[model samples]
Target: MDDARQPGRAYRGRRRAQAAHTRYAAVLTTAVVGAGIVALGVSTALPEPRNDLSLEASGNFDDVSVRGGTDRAGRSRTSNPMSNMPAPDVWILPMQRYTLTSFYGERWGRLHPGVDLGAPQGTPFTAVAAGKVILCGWNGGYGNNVMIDHGDGIVTVYGHASKLLCKEGQLVKAGDRIALTGNTGHSFGAHLHFEVREHDKPIEPLAFMRKHGVDIQKHTEAIYG
Candidate 1:
């Protein structure tokens, strides 16, 4: 009986030691996991790495290329819009006597999408082509403005006017007087701010007019000279 009791006591002691070892191992694992979490937090709090490389060292980010002008394989691209317009054979001059004050393009970091023609106040300016008047009213910045849609995405804008003679939706001939020029809206002096848009994108008005057999420079020289 004494020998059996001794063996039982020894077994109980061994079980207690194993339980304590397991508890110690669990505590150590928890501590290591907490330390790893703290290390991850400290690393994440640091600032992001900076790249001090220039554009030349990296790549050209400001390169602007015309859309639809080229393809991925370095081939010329072409497009055919369903609303393409027939080229006009002739176009009436917008003003009888005026000077080319400003041109259309980048001027002082801003895109001047139209040409400015300086004419005397109350000078009647006619339509450059026959079209239906789309807009005629007191427009913001443009003041008394007029817009004529000549179909096929071809549109003309007459801005900075003192008086609008035609009404919206009115059909006008090429030489019809649409408005009287004046110092209105954002104008410095009396002038007719004209614009030609092809599918709503502004293009060089001089080139457009010249393509229609209307030499704007010659007209300017004829009047101002």
Candidate 2:
């Protein structure tokens, strides 16, 4: 039994070498998997920026792969920023002589939902942008109203007017006079009740004013500060 050049001990030595290799392979596999996970976290950890000067949304994106992971190619997902930015236009004054008496969200008996641009009776009023007239007749509390449905879920309403110039289903361009300022229903004096809405919800006209590069406050502070 102790013959044939010690074959038993030689075979045991071969088995030990094989086991060492197997263990090394296992450790290598674990390290590769850990590195992949860390890389994925870095790729998807991008931050979104929020400000008026910047776009609405951030990242060059696609349909989310797993709500918080990369695509198969290991690239990060992002949404198109321009997709959320609404179209903006110039703020052309509708009347030659006008003043803002009431602003958006001013609390009257309840809440004043719009801005009141004061002008003389029968003064001409114009559209703020190119849009289709959705409502061209008298509204309950807004006499002789003209609501222009601008594209991209934007709408502009001219209320408390003395005359209506556009009809329903009519398309109008910017600076087109749509009505005249009046002291009609629910008005304090001769003024135009102007409203800018997004998704049918009223927003402040000053927001649009700032978008068009007009500062609500005096030019000195806005410029210096």
Candidate 3:
């Protein structure tokens, strides 16, 4: 009887071992399937790679107009919003209201190199075009001067400023405020000595400005009167 009972107990023991092995296999399969699902979800959620060719092609930081130019990467300028804006005006008056006290040419037997626009002390003035500031601070005769280098060998100068609002290497847009009127340097009163140069040679600012659609005299009259 004891031998028969031993066989029954042995069978029960084997059944228990088989049941445990089955549960372990099921748990392992569930874990592997869950891990695979998680990996698939992560891969699908990932974002696509970004293309920076548009920004690189626009060149300058200012708003660039898209007029059918292609970059080295073969990207269209119109692909980005920053490349679609309209181009800014070529030139603008330095000061809104001022008197044309002096003209460009010989002054006291010396070349003045610029025109003097007289305005009240501490009056604000703007940049004539979009460019980078190449010079800022005091010069011998110009006193608190600021110079901007537009592309194509063109540069604009602002002299006798009561205060400078821009620094060297700063990029400025047309009509952006850059300084205030002052009687610094060799100035007689509060005024802005404005100049435009091509290849470092000063030109007739009045005629040059007229060609750009900005008449200095007309601008001053409209604002002052």
Q: What TM-score, over all chains together, does every model reach?
A: 0.58, 0.55, 0.59
Instruction: List, in order, the clash count of every candidate structure.
Output: 0, 1, 0
The runs of at least 3 residues in candidate 1 whose Cα sits more than 4 Å from the true structure, single-residue gaps closed, are 1-89, 220-225
lDDT of each: 0.56, 0.50, 0.56
Any idea how many clashes model 2 has? 1
Q: Could you tell me which residue pairs clash in candidate 2?
A: 61-78
TM-score of decoy 1: 0.58
| Clashes, model 3 | 0
Query: Candidate 2 — what's its lDDT?
Result: 0.50
Tens-place lDDT per residue, model 2, 138-191, is: 654566677776555566778777888788656565556687777666566777
Task: Summarize candidate 3's per-residue lDDT along 59-168 as a digit string, tens digits.
Answer: 21121112112241133112322232332334556755578987877655556667888888888888876666656777546778787766555677788888999986
User: Which should have the higher TM-score, number 1 or number 3?
Assistant: 3
Per-residue C-alpha lDDT of model 1 across residues 1-225, encoded as one tens digit per residue? 011111222122112212323433533443344322110000001112123311111111111122111241132112212123232223556854679998887665556668888877888888876566756776556677887766556778888888889986466655567888988766679888888877655678999887765667666211111
